[model samples]
Target: MGSEKQGFIWLSGLLFLNIFVLSTADVHYYEFSLQESPFTKLCSTKIILTLNGSFPGPEIRVRRGDTVFVNVHNQGNHAVSLKWEGVKGSIDGSNELIQPGRNFTYKIELKDEIGTLRWHATSAWAAATVHGAFVILPVATEDYPFPAPTSDQTIILGEWFREELTEANQTITPGSADAYTINGHPGETYGCSNDTTFEMQVDYEGLYLVGVINAVANETMVFDIENHRLTIVGQNGTYTNRSFTNSLTLAPGQVIDVLLLPNQNVGHYYITARSSSGTHITNGILRYTTTTTSF
Candidate 1:
């Protein structure tokens, strides 16, 4: 994908993409510092656990058959464990809890599996914000089953809480999210967020691969661009027969790869994400290269 930036989780659906060139498979190394960071959203500021202080943590990209070793240092107050979704369960202690001030190294074997996958804290409380993308490129002899995109982007779908969700665990039931986000912003739909809204621009009639991950704690969200349609091309770790639809609905921790064509009139389009029930809503902007008007 082009850029997932460093902020934003997918509000409803991820909307764009690309893949990495393959090379000889080898071992890759990474480090993660799990700590608490404060963020202000939906008119409230709260401390949440984050990896290296970034929400939607850093993305891990690799080729199939490569091995990965991630060194995780737990600096936050809580114990946590991480899992590479869609892959075999955590390996070499990656699934074991990293207690506060302790460290652990994870070994991952990226076998023949391909496509977009995700990683997140296995703890219910810490999972609220600790996660990122895992992309596996096919080896030297393989290519995507569909058209290569002219451009690429990633959308991370996630929920936001005004209070520390972990703190709410003391209650009989945890609270629902206050707002959904795309790329970390609520997209001008909530209080104090006009300037923080997330947006994406596209070339008229350009073909785009949109990588999307639903990191929401416990909600299924629907994503779409007003008056536009997308073709579902891949999901989890498998590419499938192309299916066309206007919106994407994803459950928590689910991921999907879709192709989008901005073939409508040149202007700003609302990239809308909402609960499947349509009760809660948020948005991002999808504008054309020469866009000058909005409705």
Candidate 2:
């Protein structure tokens, strides 16, 4: 992933792609509905706007050079704006407001781009829940720039607030979240979250591709897993010289791709995250598959 400025919008009933001219490329189409969903966290249930009823939403997966068309239905009470400033092709997929009950479509071309990126609401506090990963895999003719892992997962780090979202038109300030979350759970470290903490089940010696995104409202997060080394292969969508580290510092909206090879004893380990300068901690569990020891 490198420079990505070629994303364009196809307006319905107004603008359309010249299908005849670009019929050879693959097209990926998706529908996203911004609906009101009840979200309960830290022992309180509140109504929040979500994409397809999911806090972290869904991944927009496509191959390099493929075109993606996302048709968004804004069913929430507030207007929405989505932004995706990705790599290499720099597909700055920023759009004007899609008012309540209105629908719009977004066209993104991932030409010459590969790796991890993201899209999130840019209007007021909508991004707190309406966000997801945008992944561009290598084109059909090419393989990954690095060794392919046996499995893959996406870890989205986000902040949570206990305060009920204000008016739909108001921007709720994220003044030091009530807790941080991994893939939507506040982990088990918080009160009333023990049973809901996210978990990763892995083989004892599996090699995995882990995509980490710092989606905290406004904080830099440091992420680490106990007894495991994160072999960073890419940062912000571009491949980098392989580097190993125990802790990774990620600014808001930054993405990291790492290879996690579990070589420790087959039990459980802790995947932890916290603000770079905060006292609170969030933790997820990494459990290795269990089996008879052939004793």
Candidate 3:
């Protein structure tokens, strides 16, 4: 009887291991190219190095335990290399530096990372523009530990310099920025000539999962939604001991996941990102849809 029980336990362990292994063995492929493109922010337009002509590049999404292959082609004038923010690179030495007009393939295994992370250039000043969100979703068969939100949104907060990025980096003194931006828009509230701003529409009583990325080059930022509380869910691809806060601080290259349960009265609220040093403050709008007529 003792021998039979031990054998049963071993078989059950093996079966569980097989299921876990199978859940994360998928492979994904992507291609990114660096090119010079005109990006306008803070009422000025300049040519900057971008991935595939996107200022914040493109989001790379995969399931946990999946393998990802990214072919990075450097068509711009500067050397480039990508460093996955929280992922381990291939064991076969796939991630290497790519010179101007050269290409290199990056292989990453999302062994255990699952949450909001990012990828950016390791070269100088390129990270200011050549970066994008990297999301490792939970396995299809697995459910979230908590109740899933109604929707998910990605918000990238970054600093903007009016001059050329490389030149600005060399000349920027302590505590300075031309503007702060949310999803590449330095919203109209900042007095910029352009009226571009990041806006999200929310239905009454719906919950939202917000993935916030602090991609600022220099200063730490505080994110807050006026008159609303946020529940901390995860950061850097890992779940955290859930907590609630009215505001949260994020340093450069940090990502945070928060759950926003809009229980306030139906109206518009300002979602603000302000630098800790008081150098800049930017605003976006959260508009709630209402069914009743205003008084």
Candidate 4:
């Protein structure tokens, strides 16, 4: 048997791909509501449209061959619909549009072999906050090609705009965002008033899996962890020929799975995401855990 525990993280609209081995197929039910909530970004706070009152919403997990039914309700004034990215089939062969004060049910089947994907509102600007991770696990008969890691985590890369996007004639052009964020925070380096940042703890000589999700609305971004090399394992829910690189490039709505083997000197390292065409940068911390440290 492999490691049974899984971890999830969200950035703007990014979703982590973490596959598990399951014994049987099952049906999963989920409720998603489109509404508004007060969110802080780039040193400012405002009410933004959201899914289930969260910026990045919730994580959906299922086994291969499982069926998932998501009931989405639009509480806001705008019409909304959700589209699953990297999915093999359509949304029951129909468009899933939920108007204001209306509800729609989305039926999706996990027919793909295995990988990470995401679900987001098809309506423009709604995806700015209405998105989440969709994870599909392999069947119990299958196992990962590589050795299972001791621990795992996810990193979601995204952008944040300071102005309201619901206004008329608003669009996400280049330079529309005030800053970028990792797991919904711009980190202390960006002068975020909240001073919140994403942190990953590791142990010496431990192998870990890091799922990277690029949910940036408009720009391709680069991801790197200081003093480490990432071994590419999968992309967009499909395993690929393994490779190694110091950094990764991801366009919007792309997901990559990488293996992190921490053999360097134990300390804190910066996990950075920088926009390829813009000056926006966000950061997280990767801290090595010692016997005396709890994080």
Candidate 5:
């Protein structure tokens, strides 16, 4: 009999495409949300800001020879300015400032480094919300010399505000303390029944390779999967934490990759992530089914 431990079942629906597998040449341009929050929690915060909404927006996982384009659309009340000067490759540092209801495009070619990275607004007014992750995976054709997952999912942790961003920034006094949020809101949303709505969803079941990117707050997240095993991968895109277990501190701009093997049986499960602050953010789902049967 094959050892269950030896069989790592992966969900490929979320997997990168073959064209992106090891292709030395590819081009992709992402759209940035200057108006709407990429996350749903903002629905409760009732706060609308200049940020994209997702803690770290979508992970741009690509291989070598990829050209990335970012089209930023300004939807907020304040004018948006992005100074890329501090960004490693940004020579001038200042990309064009996007005005309200306007858009701008940022283009760059990928080098050979494979790791996680972030793109944030240089503007003081925008940095509070305009942040996301940029990931460059090793060339696809190259053999990954590790126990990798068959499928993957992403979890983003950030703060949400219902109030207008302009109002929040103006009210925050220069010397006063600033509140850090996870997913979008603070601890949880208040409800009349005392059942404050808080927390995000994590997928349960099957084999899942998960990536959690914290964009705004510094959090030590504990991911609990019911009856499953987990392994930690790359951190900060450079620090390698291989095959380990324990809730680790993930500061802003950090990414954690873990593999999970769920309890046996073809079913569904929820992957849960909770911040040390007791804040809940994003959620992902996993479904298991026999190959002999259609999903």
Candidate 6:
């Protein structure tokens, strides 16, 4: 009897281990680097911050309800802060501080909603670097509430400054706009420039979603996707009836997802974002490259 009991216990342990392994295999993992780099001409010196050595670190794409694990490496001299601006008040929520030379892991069980999201830094020095987007899609066979496209892509918008945010904010008077960035960098370096190219192919006529994140403090942003009809999907990742037809006005921390209908006579188009207040200009290109492609 004792031998039989031990055998049963061992079998159960193995079964549990198998289950754990299978579950782990189902989830996806992504890693990113946080370093410092340059942004502009006026602030032509080196400013340190957490990023993938550039502005707008990287956009991570995953499925709804899929588990995500992010390994954060802090290469800076000071501690880093990571904040998630997804579903509120949960593990995916924002505002976390990560120490320097150390690594931390973040696990998020994505909700069953498909949209664009952002991971921002909560540290004082992190206002510039340590930012990126996450594009979450629905499961296969699931239909999007908006029109479907032959292919889709993500575009991240930001304002890049040459100096540290702390110094910029202090030197510039309050209620003044002094930020710079588009996509992820100020001068179009690191793929954040207003001239970076974006290409995609569409089936017939359909809607394409473009995500815009306003990372600055108080400036209102305006975006122009040349020759395309645009409709606002959601603000800050939440659905809203307050949709704009052509241009969008975005304040800091606001996210705008736009549904675009492309023109058949497409060669290459420039999707541009600028502060409605004339602060900065950032741009991305949308080109009709192929028939069926995934981004």
lDDT of each: 0.79, 0.79, 0.81, 0.77, 0.53, 0.63
Cα-based TM-score, every candidate: 0.84, 0.86, 0.88, 0.86, 0.63, 0.72
Q: Whose TM-score is higher: candidate 3's or candidate 6's? A: 3
Give the TM-score ranking, best first: 3, 4, 2, 1, 6, 5
Instruction: Give per-residue CA lDDT, model 4, range 1-295, as digits (tens).
Output: 1232222223312322223322266789998888888887666788888888876778887777788998888898787778888888767634646779988888887765465777777755877777777777666565777767687776777667777878462457765777777877788667657757889899887888777888777788899999999999889888888999999999888999899987777689999999888577778898988534346
Q: Candidate 5's residue-wise lDDT over 1-295, tens digit each?
A: 3555344323242244434543557788777767654333433343445455554344566654467777777787767665332134552325556788887777766654445556566554356566665666666566544555566665555544444456336332221213334333343333223222333333334456666666553455555454456677665545265776745457545677666655445565444455556544333344555423348
Per-residue lDDT, model 1, residue 205, is 76
Q: Candidate 5: where are CA atoms >4 Å away? A: 1-23, 36-47, 50-61, 81-88, 91-96, 122-129, 167-206, 218-222, 239-241, 264-270, 277-295
Of 1 and 3, the candidate ahead on lDDT is 3
Candidate with maximal lDDT: 3
Candidate 6 or 1, higher TM-score: 1
Q: List the residue pairs that clash in candidate 4.
A: 115-237
Could you tell me which residue pairs clash in candidate 2?
Answer: 2-88, 3-88, 3-89, 3-90, 4-88, 4-89, 4-90, 4-91, 5-89, 5-90
Candidate 4 residue-wise lDDT at 59: 82
Q: How close is candidate 1 to the true structure, as a TM-score?
A: 0.84
Better of 2 and 5 by lDDT: 2
lDDT assessment of candidate 4: 0.77
**Per-residue lDDT of 101 in model 3:** 81
Query: lDDT per residue, candidate 2, 125-206, as tens digits?
Result: 7787888998876655556667777888889998777775644535644445788889998888886843378799988777
Better of 1 and 3 by TM-score: 3
Which of the predicted structures, 1 or 4, would earn the higher TM-score when compared with the native? 4
**Superposition TM-score, candidate 3 onto the true structure:** 0.88
Per residue, candidate 6 scores C-alpha lDDT tens digits across 62-170 of 7655778888887776666677777443674234656677888888766544577777777534665567887777555556666665455565655544445653342
